[model samples]
Target chain A: MIKITEKPIDVQKVIDTASSLNAGAVNVFIGTVRSKAHGKNVVWLEYESYESMTVAEIRKIIDEASHRWPLLGWAVSHRIGTLKPGEVSVVVAVSSPHRKESFEACQYIIDEVKTKAQIWKKKYLKTGRNGFQQAHK
Target chain B: MKLKIKTFGITRDILGGRLVEIEISQPTVSLLRSELTRRYPDLENLNSLFVAVNNKYADESEELSSTDEIALIPPVSGG
Candidate 1:
């Protein structure tokens, strides 16, 4: 499963979707907005993506990961629009018969998304000293 | 050849729009990256950069085509 959405990530839904009878292990990684960036206190985050293409790319990632690892299931979801501090922005889930594949798939999703996926985020930060910056591209 | 580059996140805002035009003969990914860095020196200094051609992560040396979906993606450490 894969999606680029405006709704908050449903962590339980993702986990449920990835679980199967034969699978003994499941792993998930959640990314959320933080209140700081490069030493400034962040007020929020702005996330966006090229909607259609992003979705396609994410699905491709899942397809490849599942094939390469032979995992029972995998899902990735990323949130768009504005998010306040401590909001879940992205979630990834993977399940397999053992812990190793689950863990590897989870890490694979996060690291690959960082470099490969089209999703982008801007940190809206306000510093302790009252300074500000929008960290982006 | 000319190519359209779409930027987002920090790069889009810094470039002040989502797309920009670049003209090159047989453009390569490396040329695009250097051009962007040259045009926005500050962005060059600000974040780690990656180039993608047609929505896939690409090597800077990869050959480019005008029809390709090109993007300049920076490090996204945010939530």
Candidate 2:
């Protein structure tokens, strides 16, 4: 399952989608809004994406990860629009027969999405100004 | 050829809207980039930008048609 939504991501649904009887391991990565950025308090974050392209791009990333690892199932979900600090923004779930593949593939998928997906986020600082800088890892 | 390019993120901010129209003598991604930078000088300040044609990352040499979907993709910052 790969999706771009404006609503808050349901992390359990993502994990459950990747769960299967044949898999022994399910690794999950949850990305949340940070309270502070560049030493300033963040009031919120507004995420934007080229919606259709973002979905297709993430699907390709998942397909590539499957080729690189032995995986049973996987799901990637990203939330757009405004999100307050501590709100969940993204979730990646991968299931495999072993722990090693699940762990490594999950990491690779998130990293690739950060660098390659057609998504961007702007930070709204407590100073009442929106930061034009791109969100950093 | 005249084309409408979709903008998002900081490009949208820099371009002052979601879409901008431009006319280029040659319809190629490279030429489009030159036209865009010439019109919106602030776009040059982005760390990097990729031009997407029909929802895929397009090569600089790729040709463009008026009907193709074009967008300015700045460096991604999503997880």
Candidate 3:
């Protein structure tokens, strides 16, 4: 289940998908609007994807991550559009026969998505009259 | 051939939520960017933006086909 959308991600739905794979253990990672980064409050985040390209790349990323590790199954979903503080921005669910693989692979999935994938990020810093800035590509 | 590129985030705001199509005999990322930046002066700071073709992250060297979907992804907020 590789999904990127503007709606708030349904964590349970994705977890249910991973659990249906019949793996013994499932590890999940949910990234929320953090309170502070660089000493600034994160007001909100506006996620932007390159539309179709982003979806294709996200599926590719999941495939690549799954191939690189020993796992029964995994799913990654990202939320686009305007996301306020405390909303889920990203979610990764991994299921495996053992705890070790599920834990390791889940972490790796997030790390790879951050660097290897073509997705970019804009941080909405909280300051008087301040809006947003491109964190990186 | 002409390729339409969708803009998102800041790019969309700059472009006023409209699609940009540029005519190109041979559409490469570099050429497309140069041509697009020229036509859309509002997107001047978007030179560094990533271009997506047909919803797959595309490299600058990729050739553009008429049916391919293109977009300008300004930045993401995924953690």
Q: Once superposed on the true structure, which residue ranges of model 2 sit more than 4 Å away at CA?
A: A128-137
Per-prediction TM-score to the true structure, in the order listed: 0.76, 0.93, 0.74
Instruction: Report the number of the highest-DockQ candidate.
Output: 2
* Reference-based lDDT, residue A21, model 1: 85
lDDT of 3 at A47: 67
Model 1 regions lying over 4 Å from their true place: A50-70, A128-131, B23-34, B46-48, B57-67
Q: What is the lDDT of residue A122 in candidate 1?
A: 74
**How high is the CA lDDT of each candidate model?**
0.79, 0.89, 0.73
Error of 2 at A121 (Å): 0.3
DockQ of every predicted complex: 0.35, 0.70, 0.35
lDDT winner between 1 and 3, please give it: 1
lDDT of 2 by residue, B7-78 (tens): 988888888888888888769999999988988898888899889899888999999988989999887887
The weakest ten consecutive residues by lDDT in model 1 chain B span: B70-79
Ranking by lDDT: 2, 1, 3
Q: How far is candidate 3 from the true structure (C-alpha RMSD, Å)?
A: 3.8
Interface RMSD of each: 2.9, 2.2, 3.7
Spell out the clash pairs found in candidate 3: A52-B55, A53-B55, A53-B56, A120-B76, A121-B76
Error of 2 at B14 (Å): 1.1
A19: Cα error in model 2, Å: 0.3
What digit string (tens of lDDT, one per residue) describes model 1 on residues A30-119? 987766668777787888886666777677778778877869977788899989988899888899999998999889877877676767
